[model samples]
Target: MDGKTILPRSEVPEEFTWNLSDIFASDDKWNEELEALKAYPERMAAYAGKLGESAKTLLDWFTLSDEITVRVSKFVQYASCRSDQDVGNSFYQGMRSKAFSTAVALNSAGSFEASEIMAIPDETLARFYAEEPKLETYRRSIDKLRRRKAHILSPECEKILAAAGEISESPDRTFSMFHNADMRYPDVTDAKGEVHTLTDGTFVPMLMSADRTLRENAFKAYYKRAGEFRNTYASTLDAQFKQLKFFADARHYNSTLEASLDVTEVPVEVYTNLIDAVHGNLGKMYRYVELRKKILGVDELHMYDVYTPIVADADVEISFEEAKKTALEALAVLGKDYTDVLEEAFSNRWLDVYENTGKRGGAYCTGNGWPHPYVLLNHKDNLDSMFTLVHEMGHAMHTWHSCKYQPVNTAEYVIFVAEVASTCNEILLMRHLLGKTDDRKQRAYLINHFLDQFKGTLYRQTMFAEFELQMGKMAESGEALTADALSAKYLALNKLYFGDTMISDDEIALEWTRIPHFYYNYYVFQYATSFSAAVAIANRILREGESAVKDYKKFLSGGCSKEPVELLRDMGVDMRTPAPVNDALSLFGELIDELSALLG
Candidate 1:
């Protein structure tokens, strides 16, 4: 297909794919930058022993690293997005594969450098900081460095870890490449008797269709196709688990989850406690599902009806341009700095919004620890897509701020805290919309939106967390994670969460086959934690004002300046306590009541 054949952001031609020119102005410029980036890692050999020298040496190195990080990050964003646009685009794919090597080399150097910094005598570091006033700004980053220093393996061991690095990530990368290449869906017939080809782009729209028949056919089409590759998915996922086990053993951690959290200093209990809290409130979720069944008036609610539109003829159709405006308005509370970046994102085209042949499904904002975060969305002009855009931009903004304000070593925050900024954007959008809308249907739509947040982030994610934890435990206890065992666990959890309201059949049982998070090694729980914290943060910002915004920006800019959980606590939301989780669940119940009232 010609590049011009790409789908527009909407039915209109006035829309365009995201603008990357804002970052580099042209591909020629990016090539020049890529060349320069590949050269910087080798330069690190000169700084071998210099990291522990003095505050001035460290500070100078940090500045140098930041500059290099920004440039390399830009190269990465450009290449990755291009590859995503067309997984078959060999030019960009080859370039990205090469870039991956550069990244691995750079990461090796980084791990080595940070490990070396940890070896410095405490007295020497203190003396250097005292002598260099500018270094005082980095107190938190330095403190975190000190904490991680204890976990720092010997330099030789660290080199071994780095050398075998990319192999550990092969499972994920291979799955992504294969799924993009081979995953296919059957054509779905809509209520009007028109047929639409079921690609990832059309799947969600079908699910959200007001026509139950369309949703049912769409779900059947999806799983029937996905089911063909079950054995392959299972094998790839198993390899991913083995990789996790390898790293956990290599790092001297008890398990993959513990090893992963050790990167951000989050306790494993944070995950366990989240699932437990959500489990305690599973009744609320079941009731929500029950309400869905009643509202849809389906005698037997199927998983296909899960995302079916409740309000017949609901008018939640938001255009891309309007969605951009809504995002700007919804995030208006983040102060001038936030709005400024957001404005730049929209106007300057920091996103590629159009879906083309081979374009990856889903949305995310990713940047190396430096440069502005680049976002990719398989653009669909709908309210949910609007939320998706703003949600990702939140991550981009947080990444931009963290990299700008923190040193190279601490610029990357833990994924645990990473979700706070994104989900806060989501909660903010909901609050903004709910405040402005009074129409019962719109309010109901907004209420549905909030409910889905709990469904996806709180309830659904907790279920995923359960699967993750059980698998990890099973992996620890010498149980094999075969396809049947995994599917049984997933289906049973579905039964638990859905209760008597909906059917939990074998088709939905294989739903685990499609989830990429299983490869993530205990990463799903953050969605719940982040939602809890976001509820607290978003509430404070709406109830308070500039104070909350100021606090949030501090949290964003702090990055890995300290332990992420501690930074969130300093900024007002405490993940360690269950208060936020309880508060969030209470809010979910309130939505359930509102929707119940409207439908009744």
Candidate 2:
């Protein structure tokens, strides 16, 4: 497949398609299960107020909830996979909508279960566990719910909140429809006079173009359209923020950030530490920008020029099969078991590979019930794509291990620790590639790639995180989150983060309009923190070999059984302290030095 041409979903080869039938053999079967799931609300409602009856009754309720969870998970996974394959497919779209509605219905009806369990005294719960030994299996989950007792509303209030679940997502849904479905960009002519349609999917690649004129044109053209709908985006964002505040206030949280991080028991200091550490190291970013300007031989560096490859002549083309082998070789440091999981992911058709018409852009690994974790990739045959292959494989393998080792209740890891596994794979892959090659040019290319990761994941994400914090604070403080206010704040942050090395274009201010993560309260900081954690873990694995590998495996398998920070600490990285962040930045400085030497 050519980079310029996207095949339709039906035209893609079967081998590249995920075996979704592993979950349900056919759509009819999916429909059957979906219909059966409708009765789950009634079944779950039957156990309401009965959780405190006895240990046997409590175990029965847990079993029933698990059964509903398994069935609903399968239904939602199948529908989501189908819809993602082609967003325009109405059948799958309806299926996805229905699945969501059913989930909300079940949640609304089952809201009493947690409140009732929370009503049980600690002594009584312990006695119940003693009376029915099987209840001990759910002790951790029960405790987790108990920890939220302070935030738990009355049963009626909980029911009302649960019923409003679908309504709460309106802003996000509206923005998604506007961003993906309605908005369109004009065609921009490249330096060669070839016209290309500017789209969300093609915008990044265009920015990464070596042709400065093309990158600038695409940047302006894409944002110019976004600028047109600035009010719409701002309104959507405003609504989202208001919703966050509503939930926070309703749950008695001091602030929205507190509400967001409280779910995972993450301390606010982790977020603050990332911003402070990155700000302290802004000189490194400024130096990188200076290097970019010097290497590209441009008198003035602009935001649009930031993404182009510094080692343009060293552009590496890696095919899918080649990527698979490279990822396996790189990850073999984790020993045979981890490598075997990667093998299963490839051989078992666990991935839906390649970009096709109407397919979702970007990549992710999603785990549902009992089926193998599924990975979605819009794979382009380039160095970045190869790294993405390994990155997503990292996630797939994490899901595989966690799902294999833990029960349904604790199988899903929290987002705070999720990126560690994926980013760790990426770091390991880069080290493996660098180790395997001594060619100065290739090494320089790899180092440049590594620096880009640091810039994008560590520095850039921290910048976004800071901007998000400010926005949330402003909203909480009654400041209007108008387009002007958001854009001005973002621009100021850009100036502070980039320093004087690059020109901060006014259009770059509109970047907040395009980031969907802003709608996700306090989520982007995890990328920065997770990348730092990965750097520490990967270095340990490379330096200490088997011992480090064992700990890393344990971190992956622990899932949500323990606090995320504690889990990372067990793997020898304490994100609470500034050590990991500083260590990662120090490594960045070393990479820059090596690249400088190689270039000379």
Candidate 3:
């Protein structure tokens, strides 16, 4: 008999979407991985008493751990792919859920060993390295663990942290289940009379509908559902903040934000300067919103109006194949290694490109160093999809470069440096296409695309960072953040950023409910600062060419070998200063002027 098919969506194509075979030769191989993974928990448990045997034993334990990690990743990735294709698939969900539990166990077990290893006298651990040549790589990894040695407490303390991990994850887990599984929107019918359900996936398309009324209805219908869950959502976020605060205090950090950046060694100034940089350029953002008013002839622009295409049917809709070509042409400056690998990705099915009935929303590039990066995209035949392709490809290419240069031990990078390469690709693609376009309409569209990128990535993200700070401060100061407080804060900042041109309202306040990033503990700021650096590096590379590329590659190849700050310094950026952000915002103002004049 054929293997049991348990996907929520039973109508899945015969071939797995995006070729799971590339990662593993067949489903049979996936089963083998599962069997191996089932046997790993006990195998990992065997390391429990063995870690303290000697320094060599600790090193060998780590090696065994890495091998197990590789196997776990293989198991998890395959199961995840099946689930992503159809989240309702019970079989894969069970496997995926088990994989997560296994992962948590593995993490706890490793941390237990790491704590013992750190407690070993520093001089003794050093002498072990002298005895064993192969132990040097663990030296850096151990040094990092050593940084937390003080923060770590007794084995009893670690076990407490480990056991609480499941409960602590309730907020994120609740949000995902509710947001993805429970929420549904009313059907929004467009002027062409095309009726579409206003889903999180389809919300953007409905908002971009040429019909203003459709956008309005879509917004109203979507947020009505959000309104129903407001109290539950508020409670969920409260739990999340409490968890963050508890962890921060436990770790001896002064604040949660600091605790967060301590992971990447990124400075908080890099974050604040991003908000300041965008604030200094508000006039340009207002000007673009004013242009929306003038061109669309709307009496008032609303929050829903942001994604409304300012340009008419003039958009260049390229198929996925053509978009891949455009990305290759635009990223040619990154050198042949980039171009060649991207070509392989295109030909070899490294990307899951289409949106089927039950695939995940949005786009992401994810993989481990052992294998190349895998990018998942919900491709629309539009410019945003093209930019998204460029964006995710930026991440994959960065992963590619980093994997080539750094060892698996340090291959994964901080999110602080994550979006720079991706956003730079967006800027580069815009430059390439805009330079070639003589048509004023197309030029304005391209300029609008670039301007909108600044608005969403830079200005909007800073607004989010500001709100995030406020909420964290509120929670920190023994204040309760109700739905009222959350919405009020979000709407206030929404008005602050849009200035007088846009109408920021009650529905807009519901914005807080829509953002999943707020739950990430000070993560949205990275998008703002990454764009700041991307703007600087993009301009520098366009203006100075090879020298800028050389510096950028140094940053790319540097990995976690250094803190993000020093690494950015090696790339010719000083995170302590506000100059790069100032320059980027100034560039935004210039682009707004160009777009406005082109429209006129």
Candidate 4:
């Protein structure tokens, strides 16, 4: 480990950690709940063949199912969050596995529900709804199931699939273990001969270093280490896609993408449309890449150079306290209700701040099931980390709003719109920073930051989206996803997205091995789409003031109560059209112009 010491979980200050006691008072309490939950799956088995018996029977099943869901969710969340806090801890990992097994058993027990519901005639369901007043609460869920009647397999088949759930998670689990727990990155050395610990948490920060040697060395070492295990990574990725294709084909979906999108009610066109929009605007990305090379005073811009600040003087450290204060100030436009919850997040131990030994890399916000929205950050004192603080707080707030407004069944928002609130917060933060600074250098720095967001969130994620699409199709066509094949496709994408200015270093091709998102099953595309939607919404909030803020919050609170596209449409950005993506890229083009002028 370099000069920095990542504290053990036990040594981390109590104030800096999230309070898991909010979910369960202690490990004993969690175990007690686990034992109690084990009996309920058998109870669910009692309702297996009885869903279509009558209105009361169906209503009773829904009540029982929702209760189990909430409890099991809390059970799984606690164990998984604990495990995430320290991936090296076997006790928590065992607990998490048990939780998953319990969930799988419960799923198997309830596997008959969907098919039975689908089997009900339209007229019978309507009659049941009329008979049971409370059944109206699940009308949307019921209707959605009915719509997918074609996809719902026989009850016996569903039971088999349900049983396979835990086993099917093998690829993701394997990769997670490899990336977080098993893989070891070599220590990188700076020009001064000082060594730095290179880890998942430290890799990006090293790339952001002002020292060119350190950046290049860290970049080479990190990817080179990953490249060594390329075949193993490729096998896991192959299994992931194959599993997706298995379920897709089993469910009678024409393609894996179709199956994935169907769950969210998103049209396939939305996915293709995003790529089409980004492809149309490649020139903007190319121009930005060219400008980066010019500003960095480098003849060749390597992959390692991409993250270092083009406006070097503006790169500065931002303490955690400063991050929280600036986040509150920047997000004040979101009104009192949002800020109130945000304030609680800062003070109430809702965040597990700072990196620790064996802690998971990156940042995320989870509710650990309702009433407690938690954020995990490998927090560094820098502008990027400040933006990360606000970004995750956005997710925490969205979880807070959705849970407060929507019922349990519909509270969790789909992946499609999940990134909107987070990215919108980022855009707002950038604008806030830009507006407060009169100094040309500061403004250029902020603009560069915004441009980088466009590059990373918009351009880079779309490239990832493209790679995913190609891989999925290749899998469907029976093409093998070997390490060399994956790396070639990934490198080509890097070249295309970064334009001819980028070196497309061979080390970067191994990047697919490191991405946790590929296992997410077509999840990265939404980052680009969400960034587009956020650009539009952030601009509206800034322009229209209270009315826009009101609508934006409404969208956050809406959850899955309405279709995601409809919810966004209600807020004025329509994902059904290409306008949002085009508008976002237009802003990217304008920002490049703005940054160029400022630099001049």
Candidate 5:
């Protein structure tokens, strides 16, 4: 917000940047590593038809594979993080492309391992495990692969599929380029006639402004720019879903959802159960929407008005330094051990902390058990950015704990439960802030923020999940996903979810064109599902104290050591049933009642 303009990457202080050097000493070193890695595919391919030759032979391959995995993981993470730091940096862009290509080649070379392993008889494999005790390190991974024996294609077919990995990534990569690098927006002028720069990072903060004219102008302009390229986005999405369908069909799965869920051993029922639970609670959402409209005193509510705080006087700007302190204090409930690691994250520059020219919009956390986890953030001096900080740190801390506790092979957690830790962090921060205040306006403001979490994370994400499913089905039924067809379906979903409380503006229909998650086959549902689980977990942590914290920490360390659902179930939230979602919705209803009483 300094001067209301994004600084160039060179202008940003080094202290505020992430330390990618920890992954590679320099780009020359990275290139050196990259050059060496190009030879691995041939080396790995030489091991074909020999996986079942002996126990030690299998163990040797596993050891070499694990070593290469750690190296490749670091390569990809470093290149991508550098590229994301400034999407317009051509050097890092090419590095990222090469890293991905080498990764695919390596994967294609190892495609024979699965079929070869599955060819080993169950009894023979059990004996092999007994013969080589070190092989026990990979018992879970072996079991998981064997569990999918039916889906294991021939080595040649597996290689073919593996080779398609880069091509399948085209949609997401294209969208990222279009969104972060190529896309441009006109300057937005405020009610005071002050011209403010508009970018992806600024759009939401603009909507949160109290000035209605600014909010409306920003929203319409942003979407109008996106609308111009609607057909291109539609084609990319069509190709994405078709690619997903191709893989699902090849693997003998019934639908894209089944293929996606089966990878992490999640039940298809979990997805359906979320939609059903949210549908049952639509009345609560409608009430919230109605309450928001009443509080704003608007003749008619538009999508642009939805983000502005209903409590006007309580808007407060929080500095990044203050946000760090607040986050530490808020997370203190997790114990000294956890807070110590958090301090490390702050001090060691694990986070790239502000937006710069050509930086990728939004935020993410990525680490692969190398030195430590790294978080990318466009830090703003506002409540939402603080929440984003803690959310991503939640992911970073989860990565830290998992890497420390599990081996490289098992340390990586699946996407299913990835949001739980982050959401729990936000809930804890909300509790800490809410506990610190009792004034009517302040309490109402905090409550409204909490309500927005449910609306955004739980309701909106589920809406997206539903749209993803419907889109997938449309593709499967042989429908062309033209821009008009896609927009109509999206607009209808908006109408269904928002009900009669707000106008289904035409600009909002093009909203789908801007969402990067649509390219990620069925990735948004976890935000909703995990939010429900986090509510239960966060409530228990505060209510039960140390015992709950102990269980939660263990869950964080669990990585993919167990199935994701079982990890949460062991911690006492059963995602397999609707209980968690229903419980969270009940709490949402209660908060609405509280906000109503407080505002009254």
Candidate 6:
């Protein structure tokens, strides 16, 4: 459905809408909290330079910081959720802007807290905790701050960096505006000779169409516009990489990759190992592509042919209610407590379901400790949307479990393990569905869907991850990142990954310009790693049952209390090794074999 044809927010059923009032009953209350948060910086200022005074003083600073953090979380969460509910809403846009400003001010005001704590000798900090038992509550947080001692600069320099934070984000902000609001794509005609406006939302679905003409037209037309604005995209991306390099250099890191991975203490080898493993398994992907060409009966499989399903009538239309039931049933393996949260999410209006005008195109789970996590989904009644519901609910349940178990300071999980929970849910759901069905076509469709996930999340994201690493290196080496250079690099990688089975069109080269994730520094690789980890965990749960579920639940509850690698290690998936990636690729190959037999 087109955005213009979508229902207005008010017209959406109340049952389908998220309960934003749970955060604040009215705008008046939200504004009241906003005004109250504006005074937090002054309150935080009073204890800034006095952190070394005594144990009680330090405890008081932490106490005030926690209070302000809770309030800040609520404000930002509410504003963002409200704004995202309808992006065109001016009032919520202003509110989101003000909340961001308050957050920056709060950060600037509290910038000295870290440096001051670092200045306190370790022996002194130990003595303070000994003297005041209450200080023990923040030991983990303090330890985290102390770990960054080497990177912490002088208070003045830190303040400058804090002040420049908003300015540094201008490129990404401009790209967001350009991609979401400003940039326009041309309309393309489908096989039926019906014209549809090609959008980022509709682009993939068009590619998934069985009609080669529709897929080719959509592919060409979308990139034709992207090709026109290549220079503009390249300029914005160049500025973003330059910003990444500036921070890496300022922090004395060897590269942007190091700087990004160090934040979560992930080793550089984890990233490199993923690329290496994928490279080692390139034959499997090439074979899969060759299988697609053979099954689709295409003489020459182009890039557009990659997404179309090989199984006929595989795009099953599943209603939202059916999706909810299937998600609940599929996740019951996680045990009753986990399924209870999913039930609450459905009955208590935790989701803003369905596509509506101005609603965000994709799906995500968001909220704060103050309220239950809220989910936004542009749900279509299809198998893809069913998996999306399960995927997002996995995130919501993770947030629910973490907030319920962990302290507010450590409630939020890092992005490294964020996809683990969601992808695990997807894997388990796929398995459950596959187990229950013996229908040949149904099995083929389900297996095909699973294969697509591996292809998209594991291989495709790793390709993007490699591209991101290369771009960083190029920018650091003082090479100009022009449109032609970026496209050529991207096209080459596409050739390497897709192999000779498919024709790598020039239009596919413009794929880099349209990917929003490249703007995210070294972020796409985790999707690949997390999918691998999830596969291992899902396999364990299927094999070992309750014991595996117990371990997985503990991992979810731990949140940021431990580093991501250590957490995954505790869950029995060692990302540092190539085992998980190779196992996932092996499973991909097995699925292809199953589909091949079924198709025959």
Runs with alpha carbons beyond 4 Å of true place in candidate 1: 1-15, 25-29, 49-63, 131-139, 368-370
Q: Which is the better candidate, 2 or 3, if ranked by TM-score?
A: 2
Tens digits of per-residue lDDT for model 4 on 1-600? Answer: 111458988988888789888889999999999889989877888888889889999999988988987898888889888999999899998998998999999999899999999988888888998888999888888888888989999999999999988988889988888899899999999989899999999999999888999999999999889888999999999999999999999999999999999999999999999999999999999999999999999989999999989988778778788889999999999998789888887887888898898998899998543656788998888899999989898888888898888778788888899999999999999999988989999899889988999999999999999999999999999999999999999999999888898899999899899889999889999999999999999999999999999999899898788888998999898999999999989999999999999998
Question: Please, what are the lDDT tens digits per residue for candidate 3 over residues 379-460?
Answer: 7777888999999998888887887787656667788888888988999999999988799998888887788898898888
Q: Which 10 successive residues of model 2 have the least lDDT summed?
A: 1-10
RMSD to native, candidate 2: 1.5
Q: Write the per-residue lDDT of candidate 6 for residues 529-579, one digit (tens) a residue.
A: 999999999999999999999999999898788888989999899888999
* TM-score of each model, paired residue for residue: 0.92, 0.97, 0.92, 0.98, 0.99, 0.96
**After best superposition, candidate 2 residue 164: deviation in angstroms?**
1.3
Error of 3 at 251 (Å): 2.0
Model 2 off-target regions past 4 Å?
none
Tens-place lDDT digits, model 2, residues 1-600? 634567878888899899999999999998898788887777887888889989999999888888888788878888888888887677887888888888889889899977898899878888998999988778878988899888999999999889888877778767766786567889998889988877777788889888888899999998899999998999998888888888889999998998899998898889998899999999898888888888888899999998888888888668889889989888998999888878987998989988777777678888653777899998877888888888888888888888888887888888899889999999999999899888989898889999999999999999999988988888899887899998899999999988898999999999988787787678899999999999999999999999999988888888788889999999989999999999999999888888888887
Q: Flag the better candidate by lDDT, 3 or 6.
A: 6
Against the correct fold, how does model 1 do in TM-score? Answer: 0.92
Which structure among the candidates has the greatest lDDT? 5
Candidate 4 residue pairs in backbone clash = none
The TM-score obtained by model 6 is 0.96
The model with the greater TM-score, 2 or 4, is 4
- Could you arrange the candidates by lDDT from highest to lowest? 5, 4, 2, 6, 1, 3
Is 3 or 4 the stronger prediction by TM-score?
A: 4
Choose 3 or 5, whichever is better by lDDT.
Answer: 5
Per-residue CA lDDT of model 1 for 301-361, tens digit only, reads: 8998887667757655666788888888888888877898888777766777767767777
* C-alpha lDDT score of every prediction, in listed order: 0.78, 0.87, 0.77, 0.90, 0.92, 0.86
Between candidates 2 and 4, the lDDT winner: 4
